[model samples]
Target: MKPQAHPTLILWVLASLLMLAGCASPSLEDYRNRQPVLVPDQFFTGELSARGVVKDFSGEVIRTFDADISASWTDEGVGTLDEVFRFDDGEVQTRTWTLTPVAEGYRAEAGDVVEPGLMQWQGNAIHMNYVLRVPYGDGTLDVRMDDWMYLVTPDTLINETTMSKWGIDVGEIVLVIQKK
Candidate 1:
């Protein structure tokens, strides 16, 4: 014969487990007042080299690429970053980003972006939110992208992006960039 647990005790244990499971990492707000505040155009200038990988939902690497990037700031308070990417599978792509300062934070515009993206800076990180149109099978898939960049050193930056479609997480991108 086995002893049985009370219903109230079972419910309490389950509730505690659920609460623990729902706990998540710190949000951008948590770093709002931290030190080493990030500045948009200041940290992204000059020539940089990037290596990145794209992973699928299962965390399997699907593609890898390297990019030659050049960032410059205009007198009009606009920053431009030109990136030329060469995929390991022999594909080449170019993307130009125009970043302009706004009242709240900054606005990012790119050819593949659905509209202007909103960027927020905190501590040594910059968070970007946007929707990107990805070409696939003669059509396009609109994916919501939450991009984050962390400055590790004077010339080293790390980036991570989460991609989602229809509110379902699809994949992620991890990249390391070094200034030249």
Candidate 2:
């Protein structure tokens, strides 16, 4: 007698095939086409700004900073970025970033530092990430940043960020920016 086929095994194989098919990467052109329309004479101007709490090691907001970020990208994925951060108690910082296309996304550089940065359209969100120098012990410390910007409308973005180092929770911030 021939061996009988197992229905459960068949179903599991089918599901695995479907999952692999869904893992294909999106084309770079698809990325550009899907991006929100951000231009000058607008509110956001591809610029970023936010006012939110800056938390401490104790999970408390030890301070606050009002941040302003402006960036522009070229058609070929090469662009310049300007970010300004200010504290409520009188402190100011400015950073410039250079963005260039890499394997699938872009690499972000500030001064002599290099870090991974990504720009992607997931559902309706355009997310970005970078590293910043934070006041650690006797010198500046490197912290990973997960910066998120969501489009509530065609020209409006809602941003919230989380900063962390040593895999420890640091703080959270919220900001609103517009275009035209």
Candidate 3:
């Protein structure tokens, strides 16, 4: 005869499993059947404009900006997205992303990105994760960026990016991009 397991122990284990399940992040597959169906090559073409805000960890809006973007694809299918941002504090910045199509999605690279990010889309949503180096107090800090974009219309897209460091949420960016 085998000894029975403790009821309290069984309940604690089940509760721990439930908590872990709740912590799981969303996957691109989860949005596979969503609407609008975003195609990067088609939607990110031509001239575009964006307006957005940056929020700190406490959810306070720290900055805002307007940007202009020019996107084009090469004959070989490589794409370029040139962005120029004008901040409310009278500062200007620029970042250009090179996108190369791959089997799963696109490989996205920028000057400030520590590594190429995998940009994948299903239905109307696109997701990308990358590490970015940003200016800090004296030098710079590398932060993880999780980007999600949704195409609401043929000409409009909404983007949200969460910035984290050391597995802790640090900031967020929310923006809208529209074709011009």
Candidate 4:
């Protein structure tokens, strides 16, 4: 006969595993010493172009798009990014983002955003979180977006965004933007 493990012991193990998972997430401070620091006010200005793909939860590419962005900044430090996207399926979408400088980062707002997003940057990377409304079956669905951007060169940046619903990842987008 074999001895059985106690129920309390099992619960404790599961709890410890969850805590470790949460602590494993990367923080902005981790990249503080990276090179080619990213400054939104400088990199996001002028004409830019992007090419990217959207992947579903299964990691299958569902759509591809090319976008043209026109970015400008005001004397007061307010920034505007106008984007027009053309998809392979002939769908066209437009979004405009207004970024206001804050003490530590920037407050970002867009037409399809459910609420304003907070953007923070350290070293060469920037991170932002927000809820975006996307067209669904008949109406729309609000999905949380976790966006990360890294400046690799003075004129090039890589962007990655994860879309989640109810704490579950639903899709992702990977793109590269280059100044024109």
| Candidate 2: tens digits of C-alpha lDDT, residues 1-180 | 999879999999988976776466233334344456432223334766666667665667777877777878777757677878898888887878776777744566787344666754444455667777766678887787777656666766777777777645577767776543
Q: Model 3 residue 55 lDDT?
A: 97
Ranking by TM-score: 4, 3, 1, 2
Q: Write the per-residue lDDT of candidate 3 for residues 1-180, one digit (tens) a residue.
A: 999999999999988986786479778788888878899999999999999999999999999999999999999889999999999999898999999989989999999999779999998999999999998999999999999999999899999999999767899999999999
User: What TM-scores do the predictions have?
Assistant: 0.83, 0.62, 0.87, 0.90
Per-residue alpha-carbon lDDT of candidate 1 for residues 91-139, written as tens digits (9 for 90 to 100): 9989999988888787999999996798888887888889999877989
Residue 68 of model 4 has an lDDT of 100
- lDDT value for model 4: 0.95
Residue-level lDDT tens digits of model 4 in 1-180: 999999999999988987897698788998898979999999999999999999999999999999999999999999999999999999999999999999979999999999789999999999999999999999999999999999999999999999999877899999999999
For lDDT, candidate 1 versus 3, the one ahead is 3
lDDT of all predictions: 0.87, 0.65, 0.94, 0.95
Task: Supply the global lDDT for candidate 3.
Answer: 0.94
Query: Worst ten-residue run, lDDT, model 4?
Result: 17-26
Clashing residue pairs for model 3 = none
